[model samples]
Structures are given as C-alpha cells and as structure tokens.
Target: MRMMKMTVYFDNNATTPLKDGVKKAMAEALEVYGNPSSVHACGREARLLQDMARRNVAAMFGVRSEQVIFTSSGTEANNLVLRGYFACPENLEKGSKLVISSVEHNCVHKTAVDLNRLNGVSMHMVTVDRNGIIDIDDLKLTLEKGNVGLVSIMHGNNETGVIQPLDKIVALCKEYGVRVHTDAVQTAGKVALSFKDMGVDFMTVSFHKLGGPKGIGAVIMKADIDMECHTSGGSQERNRRAGTENIIGIAGAGACTEEWQVSVDKMQNQIGPLRNKLEKGLKQLSNELYIIGESTNRVPNTTNVIVPGLEGETAVMSLDMAGFCVSTGSACSSGRVEPSRVILAHGIPADEALCALRISLGWQTTEAEVDAFLAAFGEMLGRMQKAS
Candidate 1:
C-alpha cells in the first residue's frame, strides 16, 4: 500500500535534471585531491582534467579553447558581460551606454539597472514585437544615438522561448562599431549552436541548460575583445574570472558536453512531438488558449501559453497539485506574484500577462507525461470556468 508520487517536470527552461553519467564524473572529480593552480603532479592531474573539460565544452560549441571563461552560473556569465564591460573606470567616465532588449533575462536587465544607478553607465532599452522578436529598426535607432559600447541580447528567450535573429543583430551592431553579446543559456541542447558561425562577439551558455550540472557555465568571447574581469581574487580563468574553479561541477559539465547531441536529437525528434501534441491538445481544450510566440521560430522544448480568465500562478499551483510542474514566468523571478514583464514588453495589456504559463519540455519527457498534463489542465480550466 504505497501512494504514487505527484511529479511530472515540465520546467526545463528553469533548470534541468542532471544528465546520466554526469554524477559519476563529478563524484570522481572530488577525489582528484589537488588544486589546479599548484605545480605538482597531483595539481597537474586536476589541471589536466580541467583542461580536458574546457576543450570538450569549447569543441561542442565550435569555439576556441582560449575564448571560454567559466563562471559560477549563467547569471554570473551574463553579469560578467554587462558589468565587466562597465567595470572599466574610463568607460564609465566616457558615458558608454549599454543597449539591452526588453525581453532579456533579469540578470542582464537588473545588472544594467545597477550599473546605471551606482556608476554613470547610460542604459537604453530596445523594443520587441508581440511575437517577442527584437525590432531591428528600434535597435538601429538606439545605436544611432551614439556612445553605445556594447549591446546585450539573448539568442533564445527563457520565458517565451522565442529565438532572436542573432545574425541580423550582430551584423547591425558591427555596422555601428559596437560589440554584441548574447545570453545563449536557453539555446544549448535544444538547438544546434555554432558559437563562431553565429558571428556574435560574445555568447554565454549554461551547463544545466544542456543537462549538465548547475553552478557551472561559460562566456565565450571573440578574439581581440578586451574582457575586463569582474570576479577579482587570486588569478584564475586565465586571469579572467577569479576565485577557485568549481572542479567537480566542471567535470560533470564536461561529461554532459561529451554526449550533448543525444539531447539535441531527443529534443528534435521526441520533445518536439510532445510539444506539438501538448499545444494541439490545449487548443482542443479551449480556443481561448494561445501561445505568446506561436508564429515565430522557437526552441522545440518551450511553450508559453496564456490561458485567458485564469491567473498564471494559480494555474501553476493547481497543476502542481495535480502532479505536474509548470511556471508562471521565469524561474529566477518565480517568487514574485506580479505579471510577466517579458509578456508586457510585447505591448499586451497587463492583464493578459497574468495568464501566462510557461511549460518547457526536455529529453526525459514522455508521451504519457504530456497526455497527463493536458488532461489535468483541461479539468482545471473546466472547473475554473464552471465556477465563474
């Protein structure tokens, strides 16, 4: 006589469960028993493992090994780009402005806010369409105002999963002689990412987004770009990021990178169908339900649906009670009860944003899981409507 566990995770955009084999590699890394900075044999062993991980992850993203600098998380990687550039004492005095998209991750958005408040960093917010696509004309107009040293945007949005036209954005910035950086955390393992081919000056990725361990991620910078270090302490990350490296976490990330394509293929073939089925089923349940970025190109794993007449957080809680995991907005801001700023950025009414429910799928999702979520969601909507 046992009770069944109410668990069906659909929030991969927030974070993913560790990939198979990552645990063993990370646990073994702990036994290395050496500081990578030391010059002895034990230290060399740890350094070798660290080098191997750096090379493996770099190879996976089609970038040079030297360009990758590991950070504590995707958040740090992002802050490194936003804050690191502004850390230059002379740049702040020169009034170098940072142009950020309205739909960017909070790490980027909030860091920009702090820089403007603390330092004299000027900030400009670019606009996005209803489909969550960045407006190139708006960006061009902003850059034309001058003193734009760096432009920060994301390759794939975490909330709506809308894939930005990075190539276009990069080209546009190049014409204005500005460096471009993209938060590519949500793109890994869900789509093919060629860091160099994308033609971006700076791009970052999260290990956990690719089914690797959490607290380990990297920012890939192009050659000739002077990266001002943010985390200062003893020399590490080739004198880029400071403090002791997360060796165990990096090892797990390397293991995941070694077999990342298995995840990509699974997302395309398996998870894509599940998403389509889920969307189709939701449509059948109610015509009032529609996706935020439905008409645009998005990663196969994410679907941000706005269920009219129901509060998103309430729907998320009801589904959680029904053995499913979904989110009202970005997990970084999950504690807040306000409507999604990303949705509001689309120029929709504030009330529409209150109905947003972001359900992201992953490699481990199955057909049965999708069916169960759809059924539970339909029932909840039916009850909510009936009571109304």
Candidate 2:
C-alpha cells in the first residue's frame, strides 16, 4: 500500500494561520450580534468590545486609544493614509507630492501612481541598494525639493524581509517638514513596534499578518496630524473610517496582539536558529545558490534564495507536489510568470529574479517540518540538476 505524506507549510510571510486564542475571542464576540453604533443595551455591549480592542491595539503601539483607526485590511489602511493625507485641506492648497521607496508593496506603489494621475501630485522614487536598504541620501535629495507633502516607505520589505532604516528616514523627513508614512504590515506583530517612539506620522498594520483574523487592520496616526476622511456616511472609527465596525475581527486582533506581546521574546529566539539551520542546509546542497538581502538587517523568519538555473515557479510547484508549500515572491502576484520587481529593484538580472524563492517560518512551525523541508529540497535540487 502507498503511504500518504503530510503537507508542510513554510509561507508564513504571505499569511499566517489564525491563532487559537484569536479564534476564541472572535467567536465570543460573534455571539453579541449587535451594531456598535446603535444606541441600546446590545449596542453598548458591542461598543464596549470595540473600545477594548482599540485600547489593546493602542497599547501595543504605545499610543492613545483615539490614535488607532480600524480599517478593513492593510491595503485599505494604506489607501486611507495616502488618500487622507493628500486630501487634507491645508495640503490641497499647495498640491501634494509623494515620495516612496522603489521596493514598496504594490498597494503603496499603485496608490502613489493613482494620486499622480488623478490629483496632479508629483511622485518620486527612493532607490535602494543591492541589500534592499533604502538610500538615505536619495531620500534626502528627494525631500529637499520643496513642496514634498508626504513620504511613504515601508518598515520592512514583504518579499525580501529587509528592514528599512526608519529612524534615519524619519529624521530626514522631519528636517524637511515632510510627513512620513510607513507600511508596517510585515513588521507589526513580528517585531516590537512603538508608534510613540518610532515617531512616524502614520503606520499601517494588518491582523491577518500576525495570526489574527483577516479583513481587519488599523492605522496608527499622530494625534496632531490632520487627515481627511476617506470613507464617509457613518461616525465609525472616530469619523476617520466609515461603515459598520467589524467587532468580531477587532476583538480577535486585540487578543492576537496581547498574545504576541507575551510570546515575542520566545519567537525572536526560536526563529533565528531555525532560519540558520535552513540556510545552512540549503547552502550545503549548492554554493551557487544565493540568498537575497543577506547583507542587510532582516526579519528573522524569512529567507529569499535564488536557486541557480531553475525557475522559481518550477521549484515552487515541485515543492508543492512534494507536500512542502513555499512562494516565489509576493503571494498577490504569485500566479504570474514574471520576475519580482523587488528583486529587479535590487539590481539583480530579471532572469535571476525569476529563480528566486521565499521560504518563511512561523510560530507554529516545528523542527521536524524544517528537517523534512531540507530533505525534500535537497532531493528536488538533485532531480532538477539531473533533468537539466
């Protein structure tokens, strides 16, 4: 009789499985079944739950409860920040200008482009080095141009896991009187984030990225910064965002954040050893293979490697068939057979970018899973070598 193998998942950067505590919290909230905005006993109960969640999220970032505005997802939170900032009455008079890093996620890049096309906002690109770290000199030069309203840079690269120099960038922007926004979706729960200390004008985070339920996220904004409402009609999210509050999802997000705070130290210690083991095993198989963003400081759980002479999609499919799930790049554009823009921006050849695969670890991942992945990956590389 043939034996069936168990599947192993290594793509936590793309999305994480919901934590048990988060699920339980959401389930408890679901039983309330009341609109938080309505004025009644049930509504009051729902509103209290929402407020508690807000406080929890705020506490995570060392900000006031009023500063965290809930949104549907990280994408929406990002859009809200961009649109809200540009639409501000004071900024509207001077015409808005946007400066963003070349390696930012598509949501940020596309929004900047849209602002340029529709609102006559000027868009500038901040180049990054081969290590995927943004050039502070380039950012300063771009910000030096007067009339720069906002700078949007990511706290970390979603594909390469490279962390941007936020402290330096923020200081430069402050010197130029330009507001800064960071997409912290990748770094939020993975790292210890304090908005009050970070001092960015705005930062975006998503619950799904950190073992919480999907379709819920928040934007942490500085109290004094003025932002126009992107969604209108209701008095939800302190009039920052409209539509009904996602009470269940918000409850889950709070619970998830609380749990993360408890386990962050352990997670930090565990992921480094696992990543080193995986990288060492991969390197042993072939020295020709290279790790992208290896020269820069990066998140512990991620490793983006380029396998010599093999298409990333082919390798990803082969691993999938072997019961090991991984990704070529951003899961958003995974199906397309194109080189990753993040890789290309790092000055890697387009063909070489096509050979890159990203393997990420998670809190739930085990040592046995890593060992199994290494064994399977070695076998797959051998097969590819023979076939070539």
Candidate 3:
C-alpha cells in the first residue's frame, strides 16, 4: 500500500507559506539598505519604508502607528509585554502579581514562569473548562484577591483554537484597575479583530502566522501606558524596542496586513467551509475520534482532533510520509513527546491529549487539498488500526 508523494499543507497554525504580495514587498525592501535610524538621504528612504509598514500594521489592527512596537518575533513581543510592564520599579512596587490563563502560548506561559522564578512576580493561573474556554469565575476570583498588576490571556489558543471571552475578561480586569494583555498571534489575521473593540490595554501579533516573513512581530499598546523597554540600546521603536528595524520582514508584514479584511472574509466564507469538511471527514473515519473545540466558538481555520488509541506524533509522521503536513500541537513544542499542557488544561486525560492532531487551514487551502489530506489521514488510521 504505497502512497504517492503530494504536498498538502495543513499546518497553517505553525506557519503559512509566503503570498505573492508579501514576496514582492520583501523583494523591493531588500534594495533599501540604509539604516533607518540615520539622518542621511538613504536612511530617510529606509525610514519611509519602515514607517509605511508600521502604518499598515496599525491600520489593520485598528491602532495608532506610534502604539505598535516591533520586535524580533512573537516570543520577543510577549517577553517585552510581560517584562516591560512588570520590570518597571513603580509597577513592581505597586503590585508584583501577574495573572494569566492556563492555555496561553509557550512564549507567554514560559515568560511568566521566568518572571516569577527570577523577579518574584507572583503568578496566578486562571483555569479553563474542557472545551478550552477560560473559567470566568476563576478569573474573577483571582482579581478579587487584589495586588494584580496585569492579566495576560491569549485571544485564541494556539493548540485548540478556542477563543477566550476577551471582552468579558477585559471588563472584569478594568473593574479591578488591572491592565489586560492578549496574545493575538493566532486570531489577528484569521478573524476580524479590533484593538479598540476588544478594549485590552495591550495585544501581540506575529507576522509569520499571517503569510508574512518570519522574524517579525508587533506589540499593540495604548498610547498612554508607561512601559519600559526590554531591549535597551539605541532609541529605536521610539526607545521601546531598541534595535535596527527589520525592514524586509516589516515590508512583508505590511503587505500581508494591507488586505486584512479580505483575508478575514475569505477565512469566514471560504476557508471555514473547507475546515468543516475536514472535521466531518475525520469524524466519519472513526466514531471514537472527537474534536477538542468543535461546539465552542473557535478561529475559522483550526481543528484539534483526538483519535483514540493513536499517538499524535505517529499520525503526524505517517501523514508526512504521504506528503500531508499536520501537527500534534504548537510548532514551538513540536519535538516534545509529552501531552500538550494546553490540552491538559482543558481537563482532558493525559492519554487522550497525546492522541491530539491539529489541522489548521488557510486562505490558500482548497477543496482538493482538504480532500487529499482527509484521504491520507484515513489511510494512516486504517494502517495503524490493522496493525494494532
């Protein structure tokens, strides 16, 4: 039973392929080699390109250009938000406490731990239900305890694609005079997101997740928030994230975000149907198979399936051999064999969490690709079951 080698990427949650617009933008930016921080003519040209990218990103996220701080990656952006706010002497004196949802991305989760371990920032985790929705009551209870400086919750889970009740979470945090930060790395381009509407004090987004080049991410903050810079050196990014701007990556990010509304529309109208089709096919293959966030409101492009008695790593490798790409969990934690902590946070058994598979679609994902992936996945499961 030999399977043909055909590439069908279902790992959009990990990273997406670069679009033509992004490639064109990056290609043009490569020729602008001037340092944006310099005052010379070449410098001004580079600065112009970088500023255009900032404005495009700001417009896409519905924020002012000045409020977006560019960082090396989503990990750096998350670190900046956590360390910048909590490291300030006044903030640390007022409240050294930080609260975060249990299902946050590794960048957020790991940074909070590091802050607590090294900086004495008291960390509290708000629990989530089996469907990966945050426990609102648990969050409220944590807030009531007081001395909480910030609450960082992701807009959407990277593994489950479960959208948190951010509006409610923000409102509660505001009542307690606590600032809120959401890692919108997974939600920003896949759905209609508004920084003003969500009302969170800060948000983070990664460009690679939106079909842009890697090594670029942004932190969207309110103009009035007095946060310190984590990467201190020259006065770049308005002295917030001090480093030479990644002009090329920024150009790609800018191009990807220019048509944000179009991307959202396609995800809703076109990609969502294909995702539903994929889930249906998965279910029909095995009665024991179940999706993690099926009934809950999730991002339109992701599906987290748990196949009973099958290791997620094994499924991923088996599918890879057939040229279908999928994932067991976040790309950050890909090589680890342990069950997903995010999935375990949902109260799923550890054994079942190990059986999880994440299939994330994108605007480029077509019906034929979805069908091919489904066929390949079904074949892998058949072979596994027969051997067992």
Top model number, TM-score? 3
Candidate 2 residue pairs that clash: none
lDDT of 1 at 244: 81
Give the Cα RMSD of candidate 3: 2.8
Each model's C-alpha lDDT? 0.87, 0.88, 0.90
Model 1 residue 309 CA deviation in Å: 1.1
- Per-residue accuracy of model 1 over 82-171 as CA lDDT, tens digit each: 787778766554448999999999899999999889877889999999999999999999888888888999999999999999989999
Residue 359 of model 3 has an lDDT of 90
User: In candidate 1, residue 359 scores what lDDT?
Assistant: 95
State the lDDT at 373 in candidate 2.
94
| TM-scores for every predicted model | 0.95, 0.96, 0.96
Q: What is the lDDT of residue 296 in candidate 1?
A: 95
RMSD values for the candidates in order, in angstroms, are: 2.5, 2.7, 2.8
Residue 269 in candidate 1, Cα distance off native in Å: 2.1
